[model samples]
Target: MAKLPTARIDKLLSSMGYGSRREMAALAKAGGIKLDGQALADVSDRIALNPDLPQRMRVAGKALDPLQGLVLMLNKPLGMTCSHKEEGALVYEVLPERWRRRDPMISTIGRLDKQTSGLLLMTDDGALLHRVISPKMHVTKSYLATLDRDLRGDEGAMFASGEMMLEGETKPLEPAVLEVISERQARLTVTEGRYHQVRRMFAAVGNHVTALHRESMGRLHLPEGLDPGQTKLLDADEIALIFA
Candidate 1:
């Protein structure tokens, strides 16, 4: 069997944003770090780093946080910027403050403008983030759009033609699916994450999206009970659905 990865307890704790290395030493002295039900005598002790660590390790009397490859599914709220530096409300504010400090910080896989809301993904796994966002993956994203005016019946055909090109864009968009819910509301599914693509698509046909909310990415839909601004850690099965 392969040797399990190992790291100094203080280093691991600090990397997880529990505290700085010096702080971890103090925490260990105060009986705030434990492994396998025993308080650690030294913060410098080496420990196996594996999936089971969360269950076997305790920090400040609580189970350790999820390990490095964390993925989160969030119900994005309107008016929240998906940026870390922009002003006003930020999506990261909904997460535990310490998570923002994690080494290899969590970042949204793709962005949603402040005006849009719905299913959004964040991950610390850089490869996974890039895989889902890669154009070659063609991961489908579904959106529900409330429009400013009635739909012209041709909107669906136009979108599905694979010939639609947003203004100022050189390449045609891949064929998209548009399911009309009403004269003024529609659900659109797209494979590309171009800047404001959904909104731009509507504008191309002389209509405007009054409200836009993402409903799904591939087979993963936003949980109906997940309120705006709330988040859930995606498990292995849920993560697989994005590639399904």
Candidate 2:
């Protein structure tokens, strides 16, 4: 097998937003860093970084945080922008304060407008993030939309026609699935992440979306009862479901 990557203990902790290198050194001196139940005597000592590292090492008496390739699912609430510099409440604020300072900052795989809510994926794994968002991936995203007017009945066929063009866009959209729930509510599943696509789809048909909530991405449904703004770390299997 190939060797695992390694980093100086202090540097690793610092990069993970534990503290500055000086703080890590002081933490080590106080027996706050440990490997295999023994205090790490030197902050300068290097250690292999593997998936199991979180199970083996303890920092300040707590297991190390998930490593760089971490991915998480957030049940985003309405009114929070999926942005780093937007003026109002931001999705990042829901995460631990220190996580915002990690070297490889976590970011949303795609965006949900401030008026929308529901399943949102965030990750520090750049490659995985790109893979999920790439147009070539055709990752399906589903949303529940509550509209201001009753469905005109032809909306389903229009959306699935694969020829509807949103205003200001030059290309036709891929075929999307529309399942009507009530006169004014429907579930829409689309393969693309075009800006405001769901809401725009309704507008193109002369209706207005009053509320929107994402329901799923690919085959992974948001867990039942997960409250708004709550987050769950995704394991390898959960991540694979996105591509499955």
The CA lDDT at 212 in model 2 is 99
Taking all chains together, the TM-score of candidate 1 against the true structure is 0.98
Model 2: residues with Cα > 4 Å off, grouped in runs: none
Q: What are the per-model C-alpha RMSD values against the true structure?
A: 0.9, 0.8
Q: Taking the tens digit of each residue's C-alpha lDDT, what string does model 1 give over 10-46?
A: 9988988998999999999998888899999798889
Residue-level error in angstroms, candidate 2, position 204: 0.1
Runs of candidate 1 exceeding 4 Å displacement: none
The local lDDT score (0 to 100) that residue 209 gets in candidate 1 is: 94
TM-score of each: 0.98, 0.98
lDDT (CA) for every model shown? 0.94, 0.95
